[model samples]
Target: AQTVTQSQPEMSVQEAETVTLSCTYDTSESDYYLFWYKQPPSRQMILVIRQEAYKQQNATENRFSVNFQKAAKSFSLKISDSQLGDAAMYFCACRSGSARQLTFGSGTQLTVLP
Candidate 1:
């Protein structure tokens, strides 16, 4: 079984600043994928980034990057130069090789204060 947990239910960051959203997971599977998804007001789950368990390096896409600590089972998302468009519901998810579905966290709503 795999589970994801996001301790913070909500987070706020100033515009053009940086914010890091924390996430922790427990998975029995050795092969799995960690992901961060952003859902805006339109309710579209956009893939911010993904990190494979076998990969030593973390995954990054533009200003969205992940700090993947496999040993600690921690995967946190860092948003650099936050923008108003970045304000959304962020979800941390895990997908094991055997499962077709992804296990998601409760989610954290990010607010960008101008």
Candidate 2:
């Protein structure tokens, strides 16, 4: 069974500063995808960034980026110039090519301190 682990239960970042949320996973399959999903107070799950295992290049989207260490099976999210709007419960997820379901890690709550 594949599992995602988020060691941090909560994280805070000053407005305009940067923060990184750590995530590690255990998977037997080599072909898989990692994702960072943000669930704000509204409870809607939004895709922040995604990284494919085969790609050596880390995935980035605007203020969001991932540090993907494939060998260690670690994938972390880095938010640059953090904003209050970025406050949310972030979940790290993984999906193998053969599975339709995503295995999610315990969420890390990100608070943007003003």
For each candidate, what is the lDDT?
A: 0.96, 0.96
Model 2: per-residue lDDT, tens digit, 54-78?
A: 9999999999999999989999999
**TM-score between model 2 and native:** 0.98
Question: Candidate 1 — number of clashing residue pairs?
Answer: 0
Error of model 1, residue 42, in angstroms = 3.1
Question: Which residue runs does candidate 2 get wrong by more than 4 Å?
Answer: none
Worst 10-residue lDDT window, candidate 2: 42-51
Report each candidate's C-alpha RMSD, comma-separated, in the order given.
0.7, 0.6
Clashing residue pairs for model 1: none
Candidate 2, RMSD to the unseen true structure:
0.6
Instruction: Estimate TM-scores for all models.
Output: 0.98, 0.98
Q: Which regions of candidate 1 fall more than 4 Å away from where they truly are?
A: none
